[model samples]
Target: MARLNLWRWGVFGLAGLYFLVPLAASVVFTVDVPGQGLTVDAYTQIVGTGGFGSSLLLSLELALATIAVVLLLMVPAMVALRLGAPKLRPVVEVVCSLPLVVPPIAFVAGIVTVLKWGPEHLSRTPLFQTFVAIQNPDFPVVLVLAYVVMALPFVYRALDAGLRAIDVPTLVEAARSCGASWPQALVQAVLPNLRGALLNASFLTLALVLGEFTVAQLLGFRPFAVWIVNVSGSQAQLSVAVSVMSLLVTWLLLLVLAGFGGRSRTTSRG
Candidate 1:
């Protein structure tokens, strides 16, 4: 068993190194180019330019906003499914996971076309206008929507597992016995139990959103990914720096989320 464990660790380390080799090469290449000779010029160039900063903030905002909206939609939807229609679980799960089946580029294209034409037909109505406004014309609303859709599966699965772990039937009965309403039981009991799941979903969503480039590029959003692409073309050094910064930011957000999640889990257990 010890030998087996050692073999497994060896395999895992090799796999990790294989994945990290490209990044290592990039860092070495950025530093070792003759005249440059181990300088921090790349980092300085990326940070000195205002564009990278603006794009970083935009990406952060986009991820946070997407997470908030997704949580709002997912939590109640999950609760309702869990409490009201257990039989429809399969259907609900399929619907939420549909984004994974569809090609992201195709999804973005379809959404963008519909949104573009929607305003023309529905221009006179306030509701239509509001809808159109929410589907941001400049940034990629389609891409953000795609992120939300992709995130649903993770969020739903996590919450579903959390709900199952809590012994929902007992909690519901206890809440009812104490004269607590359905909403009260859900808010005060179920939600607390699901905090770790929610935190996991949020961090995963953040990581996806931060690194996303295809949808943002396809939809014409000036997000960090797009900025990185543009910078890479004009200045490779600056682009590397910006990428490093973005990585750091992502790591920081993940750490914060994990910390809070640990506390919430401890509180829930206590």
Candidate 2:
């Protein structure tokens, strides 16, 4: 037992070093300006940086939109597949997983093509406004649509796993027998059980949107990730500093998510 414990700690320490070393190096790079020795200008300047706040805000908005839309579209479809048509679950799963097979570069290319085609081919029709509206730089609906597709597989898997763990049909049936309508049963009994799954799906979608640069950059929109790259050319140290902070934030969120999921599992077991 002592030997096993030592081995466990050794592997953990190694893994920690592997992650921490690069981050430490990045921190040093950001603060240790050649002759300045150590300064925090890089970190401090982040707030004043021209596009930093707007880009971060835009990314957060996109993340929120992506999470809400994906969950709304996926949760009911998955529940129905669970309670009504079990065999169709596989088909839906395949459809969701299709995004993983498509490369990001190709995906952006297709989006670009569609955007170009809409202006040229559909310019005369009123529906052309539909295309124009979606591409609005202030809040691009097009990005949300793309993110929903990208997030489908993760959302499906999380929800599916959650459903499999509990007896969905029994819960819904009990709710129905107790005089609850479909919407009420779903809102009350079903979603409560799916709390952890919903959180997981939301976090995954949030991460995808915040980290995604290809689609946003290709579409000429400057969200958080692209802003990081854009500033790198001029403010290298500040860029690194921002990168470190964002990574720390992401890790913090993951830890919080893990704790939430762990509690849900514990409660379910109890």
Candidate 3:
């Protein structure tokens, strides 16, 4: 027992060092200057920076939109498949997982080609306005679409695991027997049982959108991640501070999500 305890402590210490070391270095680098021992100037400067507010708000909006779109698209489809056609789940799963195999650059390239071709082909028609509206800089529908595709794999897996854990057919039947419509059955019966899965999916999608850079940058939208990169060129310390702040935000979000999810699981199990 003594040896086992010692081994556990040793493993934990190593794991802590692995994560904490880099965070410590980042803290030092952000605040430490040649002559200044310690200063909050780097952190303080973040607020004054232009584009910080707009970029962060834009990313937050995109994240919310992505979560909404993913949930609306996935939840009903998953429930329908589970209850109506189990065999089709595999086919749907493969489609959702395609995002994992496709490189972001390639995916974005296809999107660019489609967007470019749309106007050229659909020019002089009302359809061109539809294409133009999607690429609007203030609220880029293109980014939301790309984010939904990128997030599909994670969202599907989360929801799939939750569905597997619950007996969907039984629950839906019970709800229907009680005079509920299919939509109401899903809302009142199925979704309550999927609280944890919903939180997990939303958290992953939010984090992915928050940290995603490649797609947004390549497509010419200056989101939170792209803004960080752009600021890095001009204000190195402030950029590092922003990175640390973003990391803290991610951690805070995860903790809150886990808290709610864990409580839901515990209550349900009880």
Candidate with top lDDT is 3
lDDT of 2 by residue, 46-132 (tens): 999998889888888998899889999999999999889998977898999999999888998999998998889988999899998
- For residues 1-270, write the lDDT of model 1, one tens digit per residue: 999999999999999999788778777766666775787677667767867777887888888878988999988887887778889999988998887788878887887787678778888888686655665744545556778987887777777777777777678778878888988987887787788778878987898889888777776777888889887887776677677678878899899889988887678677
Candidate 1 Cα deviation (angstroms), residue 240: 2.5
Prediction 2 global C-alpha lDDT: 0.90
- Candidate 1 similarity to native, TM-score: 0.89
- Ten-residue stretch with the least lDDT total in model 2: 248-257
- Model 2 CA RMSD to the hidden true structure, in angstroms: 2.8
Candidate 3: pairs in clash? none
| TM-score of model 3 (CA atoms) | 0.94
Ranking by TM-score: 3, 2, 1
User: What lDDT is reached at residue 133 by model 1?
Assistant: 60
Models, CA RMSD each: 2.4, 2.8, 2.2
lDDT of 3: 0.93
Score each candidate by Cα lDDT: 0.79, 0.90, 0.93
Task: List where candidate 3 sits over 4 angstroms from the true fold.
Answer: 256-270
1 or 3, greater by lDDT: 3
- For candidate 2, the TM-score is 0.93
Backbone collisions counted per model: 0, 0, 0
